[model samples]
Target chain A: MEALVRPKLQEAYEAVKRALECVHFCILIANCEVKYWGRASSKLGRGQRVIMLKQDGSVLVHRPYGYEPVNWQPPGSRLSAELKDGKLVVRAVRLRPWEELVVEVYEVHLLAHCKLRDDARFEMYGSEGDIRDLLANNPELIEKGLKRVEVERKVEGGSIDILFIDERGRLVVVEVKRGTAGAEAVIQLKKYVERLKGELGRDVRGILVAEDLARGVRGLLVREGLEFKKIDLRKLFEVSKEQGASLTHWLTRC
Target chain B: MEALVRPKLQEAYEAVKRALECVHFCILIANCEVKYWGRASSKLGRGQRVIMLKQDGSVLVHRPYGYEPVNWQPPGSRLSAELKDGKLVVRAVRLRPWEELVVEVYEVHLLAHCKLRDDARFEMYGSEGDIRDLLANNPELIEKGLKRVEVERKVEGGSIDILFIDERGRLVVVEVKRGTAGAEAVIQLKKYVERLKGELGRDVRGILVAEDLARGVRGLLVREGLEFKKIDLRKLFEVSKEQGASLTHWLTRC
Candidate 1:
């Protein structure tokens, strides 16, 4: 379902069929005061709030800014409602891991419901090889005086994305990723550094590169004495073209 | 600010003017393989990967299905690009928490860049007050023969969301949350139950009700000998309306 505008009470009823259904989406607006009775009572004075409902029987009462909802009901709950003394009442109940949600509505302005589609497939983008070629030819695109000495430099452990010689005459092993770098990437880079160090008979610095780094990968890189670089891939292609339509040139040759 | 597609290399260069400039969003499609060289070496064989770049200098390469990217460079990284041997080469470098990303593109299909807007504001939602009112009137909506005897029944510790008498006439103390029911809710319910048990002159069984329960809240409920119930707010509202057009009747009376 796309969207619903202001819905009457009956329309609201039709929107939420059952808790066991796939998923239902509903939005509600109301102006009313509330007080809860349980281990204690909480009183919310007369005001307006928005209410969202899901088909799985989940509900959320949201406010501004904060991520957490003001009130909510978890999924797998039995739901029912009624009106008492002119106020709208809603109730949700569950058996196992039991819970309940009761809402009182003083005024209702809009109730929107929608059904989300889950069968849509996302479009595929490029691949890892494309990123590699872009970075290999333009070693200086990463750092000044950084010269790309070799591509796919083989090591006992694996392969280096680019073998570079910095202006300081130091061997730099470059690891490139076209995707978000994870802890696994850090570990992989460390392995290459170790292998390159033995072959060169000198300390070889390692660089872990990717489009994005995951939450904890950066911290691991620091501990392992490694470096990381971010690349604006689109810029790489753009700069390469300005350097002489290299991509078009390469594509034609390939 | 919107989107740039199939831009020339110069356009790409102009779009990514500086590392410290405002955020930029770039999407690149490439046919590329990737490798990591640091403490180790890891290779991602030739395949398709979507590379995403942000003005914050963060980049992500995505494949399919997985939530995390195969490789990434975090923010605060200096970005540079160049063309080498016909390949589009891109690199990102960072000093503090040092890191780097080197991308070599074998082929490029698309390069899309956009600047996102931050002026959007979300709408508000209904509140805890509504839930409290809904449950207060229809205690049975939570549990059969459960009568809400009082609201915010206070004890020495705190107020309970609801005070009820079950079918067997035993006191049931309920703690309600309009939001996620977490460890805090369990603790709060336990305090109310302990106090209510003393004042009610009989054993008090506690139940915690909320829109949803968080990770550890259930374990806490078990430890405290309390029960949990999930609520579906929309169904509750729907059921209430079917019971009677009470809301409309009340509105008309008002």
Candidate 2:
């Protein structure tokens, strides 16, 4: 990791381009405001936040309050920075799925490049198939009266991670992700819901069940009329073990 | 960040999906090998390395020996995991770019999620532009005979950061990046060189000058027929001070 402290305007300007071009992930901690143009013009008030630019050209404007970024540009976006009129104007744009971000630099306290590595080792014992099989056998993992009808349910576009029958006997397609769910996973879940709705000849609800969700994904899920559920696999496994269920059997079956 | 110990197979499976769905960056440190299928199939022998899945769906397999990952999948790739015959098979694929990665996990030691944040503040006194300007004014920074012709030269795609004439009187387009330069930076430099090639009516050499270059990017620069030059801004600033040159003056002039 390399740290840059209180660089000049031109230095900061060049840093943005260099960071974007070099694929060196950067976190710009600054007290500034953001302005957006292109599809719809908007502005954000000055606040202390972190602006993370991944090597793949993704940009995230994150405030200190939440885990989600206030604004972002997806991967593969082209980033440009200029020191114009004493302000560092940083812009990121993508062509195919059109998106744009413009950040006006008012004050930059610190900028650092991170060489991310998985430093510590962790032993992950359980498997996704284990969760699926557990849910398939035990509906209680979801809620009382809701039962899982099938595991790895196949659909038109792809396979649904889990298919369930709610308390009211409504078909539910559950998309599972390990850590925090992002916009991509939600979009995928929406597709599954739409596909299942047509195939089942009825309305289907989508539930994105993950250990956690990115700051903004919950809003997206609600807007898309889907549900978000946080499930802890480690705890779930402990509970299953207390019930004396055969995990090895479930693993084999899955 | 969450840590699990010797989790059941099902727990592990669910963890992978949850991690991928949720945007929590994951580091899978395992004693295993990898097999990639897309964009030219290849396999890596068994070794101890870290497989990092970023919040943006990018995957990097890094070994301890080098700064760059042995294999990587760019952001926006779709990752899927399955437990087949007791082996964890992880796959990541991208459509538009046509890339795929498959990792067969024979054994797993640890899996962890990192909540990345800048814990400390750093003050970068001088700037990359200062180094560029100093190098521009003082050819000795690069070599004795290299002289900068233009600070920011206009080109078709965009402006080349710097244009210099090498010792051999050959045109050299310089792209300066902070910290470590990656493949993306090299690719951008390549584009600049290609554009300059037609306009200059001669072979325009390219030099990616940065604080450091990532392990993989060096090879890329060589393969692309470009040059890699390391320029330490801190050292250059110190040298400028010794020369009695006012950095503030040079900065304002640049």
What are the lDDT scores of the predictions, listed in order?
0.58, 0.64
Residues B1-254 of candidate 1: C-alpha lDDT, one tens digit per residue: 22233445554445544322544545555555554332122346555555556555655554422222455555555666665676565666655534455666666544534343222232223466666766877664577557778987667756777888876678998777876788888888888888877665678999887768998668878978999877655444433432342221211111
Off by over 4 Å in 2: A1-254, B114-125, B128-130, B133-254
DockQ-derived CAPRI band for the predicted complex in model 1: incorrect
Error of 1 at B125 (Å): 7.6
Best by lDDT: 2
Q: Candidate 2, residue B62: CA error in Å?
A: 1.6
TM-score attained by model 2:
0.31
TM-score to true structure, per model: 0.29, 0.31
Error of 1 at B235 (Å): 25
Fnat values, one per model, are 0.00, 0.00
